[model samples]
Target: PSNNETEQHSSQVDQIEEEPVRYELPLRTNRDVPPKRYTPEKEARRSRYPMANIAKGNLSPEAQIFTTSLYFEEISTSVEQALESKV
Candidate 1:
């Protein structure tokens, strides 16, 4: 009976060794702030107000609506000079 008990204990140890062990890792997530949601009403309200920031590009905001001869004068002069130089 003692020999049988020892055999049973050895078999139990063998069963435990045969099974695989697992390691679990914690999940990661984005910690940064979420972006603002877009709405048509908000865009409309923004469009109603004039932009405070400085205008970009060669042409001014006022001249953009009506492109007068002054804006193209520099371009035309440069082209005429280039043509004369070639001749």
Candidate 2:
């Protein structure tokens, strides 16, 4: 190729390389996990999820009792352990 054509091609390549591709990311509560964004479809789907309902304070009785039992069990076991170990 001619010098001018090669220089122009190199300049185009340089310009292309200088601009980095950026991707938009959704809101995240922490570094690892992205937060749940409520779209209409997701709202409908998550409505049937017990954990999701618990998050929204719409827990069913069974879920409430189970979660309460699990919570106290974990707390009594782990928290007491932590206190004992001075952790």
Candidate 3:
């Protein structure tokens, strides 16, 4: 090889020696554990009073009218739509 080629190769090797070496990160191994099962009585309480389930013994007549009106409006709207499509 020529003297210029040897000098250029030595210059590249000197630049590489001056630069810091790269490193890889270590792998993580930590994980979380889940909670255990729920009891039967706890399940019953959540089921019985699910936000919309009004107590028959506690609701007044006026409140009942409001609830029934909502149901009737929904039923009437569905029925009207069904009838209109038949033609």
Candidate 4:
């Protein structure tokens, strides 16, 4: 390598090294709001219907179990039919 080429390469590397790294951080909002204090009426209302607040979407446990059992029965019947046909 020539001396001029080596100096140019080193100068380019030094310029890259001298550049300051800048970090763009997201703006932070004030998140120190005080928690809400429950009144006596609110507390009583919450305690009154704890179960009602629970999320039991569409199918209940009994319905889910029945559906699962029916699915397995259908799969087993298909398997039995396939085996009988092979024999």
Candidate 5:
């Protein structure tokens, strides 16, 4: 390349380098806590699992009955075995 063209290219590069680099602040939320929005997608995903409902204390009557019946059955069985062994 010619001297004049080389000088022009160097000057152009120098001008670019001399220009102040602009740094933008990262996008941030002003609130310390995130806003709670009701998302139908999340609701639908949670509703897809039966255990999630139980976890949230939304037990059906039948489930409550079954759980209590099983608990009582275990207690009754243990008591019966204890009585039989004593006899």
Candidate 6:
């Protein structure tokens, strides 16, 4: 009898309700954060990887053309500049 009363009370206590969730939009704090600008020198290095890979075997007819482009020249120039600046 005591066990049944305890179980009934426990079940009633567990039936308490919960509040629904409310959604809010995010507030931006840094409105003045400037957008990124791309330069030709920066873009040259970015284009080197694919060209380098394609020129790996030196098999493609365009491989020579690809490696000899102005893009690779910029990459080489940047690397040399970096090394020179260190000394």
Task: Report RMSD (Å) for each prediction in the order shown.
Answer: 13.6, 15.3, 12.2, 17.8, 11.7, 14.2
Ranking by TM-score: 4, 3, 5, 2, 6, 1
Off by over 4 Å in 2: 30-87
Q: How would you encode candidate 4's per-residue C-alpha lDDT over 1-87 as one tens digit per residue? A: 999999999999999889698898876664676656755565433476654454546779996677567656633358778787677
Q: State the lDDT of candidate 6 residue by residue for 1-87, as single tens digits.
A: 699999998887776553456788687776787766755565444564564465456457576666667465533358778787677
What is candidate 2's local distance difference test score? 0.71
Global CA lDDT of candidate 1, please?
0.64
lDDT of 6 at 27: 78
- With a 3 Å backbone cut-off (N, CA, C), the pairs that clash in candidate 5 are none
RMSD of 2: 15.3
Per-residue error for 72 in candidate 6, Å, reads 13
Question: 24-54, model 1: which lDDT tens digit per residue?
Answer: 7665564475655865565444554454442
Which stretches of model 5 miss by more than 4 angstroms?
A: 1-3, 19-23, 30-52, 55-65, 70-87
Q: Which stretches of candidate 6 lie over 4 Å from their true place?
A: 1-22, 38-49, 55-87
lDDT by candidate, in order shown: 0.64, 0.71, 0.71, 0.70, 0.69, 0.64
lDDT of 1 at 51: 40
TM-score of structure candidate 2: 0.23
Q: Give the per-residue lDDT digits (tens) of candidate 2, residues 10-72.
A: 999999889688898987658787667755564333445564345636778887788878756
Backbone N/Cα/C clashes per model: 0, 0, 0, 0, 0, 0
lDDT of 3 by residue, 1-87 (tens): 999999999999999889687687776444354445654556433565464776756779998778778766533358778797677
Task: For model 3, give the RMSD to the true fold.
Answer: 12.2
Q: What's each prediction's TM-score?
A: 0.22, 0.23, 0.27, 0.29, 0.24, 0.23
Candidate 3 lDDT (Cα, whole model)? 0.71
Error of 3 at 33 (Å): 8.4
Instruction: Sum up the clashes in candidate 6.
Output: 0
Reference-based lDDT, residue 55, model 1: 55
lDDT of 6 at 87: 75
